[model samples]
Target: MGDTPTTIWPLDDARPGEVVVIARWSPSAGKSETIAALLPELIQQSRAESGCLGYQAYRPDGADNGDLVLVERYADQSALDAHRNSVHFRTLVLERIVPLLADRHAVVTTVQ
Candidate 1:
């Protein structure tokens, strides 16, 4: 398997401290297992990071589409940036996740 290209998007006019990353994958070749396998590690890493307040992953109810949502809160933009650069995040995304996703989209957003 090889690394697949992933897109990262910053959500609608969000401020500096909070973020929500939405991930979408192809339906027939879903990424549920991959996300499940990686989520624990990702959560742990996020929690341990300097700026992470909370991080969670979810699958929308009644939705057959291969979509996953990650809700993340940080102390500030610096924390979120730190998460992006963290070893765990890098490893999870590049080594574990990229190979499994047929298509991926990430949107970073903040709460009002």
Candidate 2:
């Protein structure tokens, strides 16, 4: 395992009605395409959810851990919860995604 980048966003200084979710995923079986294919569905589901503020994905340059990051913001905790419980999330994780990932990390926080 490599040293994964630690990303901490200060919600205390964030704007009102903002929530944050950060995630990192590493590919298994040398297959990044599987992860990439699933992203659009994830983003669409997240963006369509009520109270979504913003959602984006990123890949770090020159990272050894095959790091892929997802950054998402919502209007509040309830919205974040809805995102977590969304069908698209469930389907992707259970049906299409988990088997392809070597590692995963996530942090969800509310803006103070």
Candidate 3:
């Protein structure tokens, strides 16, 4: 009998797959508007990526929690990696937005 190797979708050797990332960002006091203002440019730049399937951001309804939710889809892990390495992500997100955020949370999943 031949032995079959076990493999994980993303952690193992998967290629040309689908990935989804959901992120929540809570802005620091008085910084919600600043983050909101930057979202348009962020969306524009992100959507222009070759491997980006979808990019959307939302503000929770009822009361101002100053939290922004982002749902992003990519063609594969490489695409997601590219997104994180992009100039806009580095400058706008890591540099500008991260400093203004009180907290941030994210989850990454691969489509089966």
Which predicted model would earn the best lDDT? 3
Per-candidate RMSD, Å: 8.6, 5.7, 11.4
lDDT of 3 by residue, 1-112 (tens): 0013342222233234689888899999999999989888998899899998878787656638789888888888999999999999999999999999999999998877
- Compared to the true structure, candidate 3 yields what TM-score? 0.83
**Residue 28, candidate 2: how far off, in angstroms?**
0.9
| lDDT tens digits by residue: candidate 2, 1-112 | 1124564442334676588988888889667877787788778777888888777777877866557887788888888878778888788865677788888898887666
Instruction: Give the alpha-carbon lDDT of every model.
Output: 0.64, 0.75, 0.82
Candidate 1 wrong stretches, greater than 4 Å: 1-31, 110-112
**Clashing pairs counted in every model:** 1, 0, 0
Report the CA-based lDDT of candidate 1 relative to the real structure. Answer: 0.64
Would you estimate the TM-scores of all the predictions? 0.68, 0.78, 0.83
Better of 1 and 3 by lDDT: 3
Ranking by lDDT: 3, 2, 1
Number of the predicted model whose TM-score against the real structure is largest? 3
Q: Which ten residues in a row are the worst by lDDT in model 2?
A: 1-10
How high is the lDDT of residue 2 in model 3? 9
- Assess the local accuracy of residue 83 in candidate 3 as a C-alpha lDDT between 0 and 100: 99
